[model samples]
Target chain A: MEFLNASVIPYFNYWIYVVLMMIGLHAMITKNNLIKKLIGMSIFQTAIILFYVSIGVKTGSTIPILEHHHDEGHAETAHAVAESGDHHAEETDHEKSDHGNNEHAIEADHGIDPDHFANPLPHVLMLTAIVVGVSTLGVALAISQSIYKDFGSLEENEILAKIKQGGPGVDV
Target chain B: MIVPFDIIILIFLVITALISLRVRDLLGATMILGVYSFLICLLWAEMGAVDVAFTEAAVGAGVSTVFMIATIYHTRRHSSD
Candidate 1:
């Protein structure tokens, strides 16, 4: 009860993701069909990606587009913040309440609070992961098609049995 | 983010994931998987991962579903277990 009340409420996102990951793993392990296995693999991959993306979530923080102030004090604040790194740490939450304020061009990171923006690194990395997952799905599906063509079945046990038979067409 | 909204979407996501895996027809499962991907993308977008959501919508939900369907057309759709 204490665990549910205290820990689970705050971190329910992580908990649900863990449940999803387990579901994917179970499907991957117990499913018999080749396409089902691939679907499970995709589920597992997406769950992992979602977990990583959730890591970057900061409560009340806007998207990580640091809108430059473009005022006279901008350069001064940038230089001053660079000199005193500890100050920017405390003000990230209050300063970053807006999202569509990207009129100005790119500026130095010293002026804004780092915590004001959700971490971009994880999202970026997951983009690559998504690409790899899609490519892997395509290739694995193609290979499964080939497997079906060879053995005339997509069930794992049947494929194994056919391979064990060592027929003339059993190149696999 | 709104906590209740996030919770709702996450719950829906888990349900969709489970259904997709449990469905016997490969094509139906793939379609449910696409629904799962779209839910995740919506979650990402609401949580401020816009670019990540965009990519997921494009790759995970759109192209991957088509890929699975194309493969299904060539292979068998029913699963024994």
Candidate 2:
């Protein structure tokens, strides 16, 4: 019960994806029509996308864009470090150039906080997936159209029957 | 853990999916599938995946539905099974 409350309850969105995936799977398996199967495939694909997107969500967080205020904070810290380094440079004038380079690196590091931004890796990957899915759907629809043109039906068994008879339409 | 709005949207998604599968009319199934995609789009946006939601709305709801409808127009809309 403790594990359920801690782990399972917090990830309710994943449960929604699981249910959706099962429904899509059932449709893909049981449906006879090609178009229906395509619909099922789309649903399945979207469910998987949802699952991935949900994994990236953080509570009370905004989008991945770094705000101007964070940038200002980084600049202020960098400026303070440079001021302190200038005092040290009076004691050791040889390292002044190196300290300037280090200041730039520190500023870059402080410019963004990982926890403040949503995970962008998943978003980039899913964008490719969405394009691929659209292309696959297009090709599948084209094939189904050709099958209908040749076999005169989109039902799998009917197409098989037509193929078994070695109909003239099968040649095309 | 449970957001009432998300739960409501998920329920609608499940209902649309079931209806799409069970409906005998191919066109009706396609339309229901469009509805399913739109709902998922909203859900993803709510989950802070605006990029994914945008893509899904365009591909799943917009182009895919149009392609399926065009294919249905070319092919037989009724399944003989």
Candidate 3:
């Protein structure tokens, strides 16, 4: 009960992914059809992708994209910085104002809080993985079709049985 | 982000995976696997991975299903498992 409340309830996302991965593994191992194995492989890859994406989730955070200051624009910010430098040239108390500017810069650095946005690194990585999984699935299915043409069946046991008979590859 | 919604989708995801793997017809299994991909893609979008979700929707569900179906067209339809 303690473990359930502490671990299972809070991290149910991970537990579900674990179960999904096991289902894929069982299908890959016990299923006799080549297409079924390929399906299992797809499921397995998806589970891992889901796991990574979930890890990057931050509660109460927005999407990773930062809001653009489109209205003000880059040129406006640059203009402001240039105006501040002009004040340094003519100001009688430049030293005092420079000390205040340093404090403002420190505050600006502190404004970059990570909790406001979701983690994007895992998502980018998983995008590549999703592409790779589809390509691998396509290649494996092509191979399965080729094997079916050569052996006349897609069942692994049947193919093995035919191979044991001194083979279709040998005579046919 | 909503707790109940996540739970519902996850339950559906597991159900889809099992159905896809256990179905005898390779074509039906392929379709169910597409559903599996669609659900996971939804999960990603909800989790704020919009780009990943878009790619998964296009590649995993759309293109891969077409590739599988095209192969099945030339090969045997029923898988003897």
Candidate 4:
């Protein structure tokens, strides 16, 4: 809690994540070897995923679980406070309730309304990315294996050489 | 808090990148790259991107490392030198 009072620093972490993402992407783009490039691509993609998940986190907030029965007492007190207050206070509490309802709607649309707490969008997207990455890896490995078997070497140059030497009919 | 944590993560990331580049042994480089992914994952979590961190932790640190090492074994293990 003490550190929370310090200057706004939460945004700095995101900046570093972006920088790392760019560096990894640069490597993926410039690297020559196929496998090295794939590694770079993984790094690049992962940096962004990290960025997405981090955005959903809220300080001091636990997982969004509704304590409906427990919250009843608190809500009753809040209602009492509103009833005793002047019109402005009553209007303010009404506004707060509306805002809460709006948030609940958004959470429902996303189908991740777990106590109205975490942002579920990022989790859903990450799940998709994980599946896609694995599929891509499988395909890449299959291709690499086929290349090695055909050329008797993994280097791109060696494969080209074997292809040239065979004059186009030799298949490994 | 964010500033210092970010700076530290950045330094580790740079070191990992340099090592991955300068190291001649591909296997060693791939291992270092795995470490790089892990550090970056922490950075992401710090940024409030829990979902992203989860994926990075799983795919980047777990699957990708295995993929790289398996490829290296298939290609380079057979080589005598």
Which candidate number has the best DockQ? Answer: 1
Candidate lDDT values, in order: 0.80, 0.73, 0.79, 0.60
Number of the top lDDT candidate: 1
Instruction: DockQ for every model, please.
Output: 0.82, 0.54, 0.72, 0.28
Candidate 4 off by > 4 Å: A1-14, A57-118, A165-172, B1-3, B47-55, B77-81
On DockQ, who's better, 1 or 3? 1
Q: What tens digits encode model 3's per-residue C-alpha lDDT throughout B2-81?
A: 56677789989999999999889999999999999999889888887888899999999999999999988888899976
Model 2 alpha-carbon miss at residue A66, Å: 2.3
Looking at model 1, give its docking quality level. Answer: high
lDDT tens digits by residue: candidate 4, B3-80: 576668867886786567446677887888888878877866665445556777887678877887888888763321
Poorest stretch of ten by lDDT in candidate 3 chain B? B1-10
Residue-level lDDT tens digits of model 2 in A143-168: 99998888888999888888888887
TM-score of chain B of 3: 0.95
- How closely does chain A match the true chain A in each prediction, as TM-score? 0.72, 0.68, 0.72, 0.57
Between prediction 1 and prediction 3, the one with superior lDDT is 1
Give per-residue lDDT, candidate 3, residue A86: 51
Candidate RMSDs in order: 6.7, 9.4, 9.4, 9.3
Q: Tell me the deviation in Å of residue A33 in model 1.
A: 0.3
Please write out the lDDT profile of model 3 over residues A46-110, one tens digit for every residue.
99999988877777765666455333453232233333345354434445352223222312333
TM-score of decoy 3: 0.81
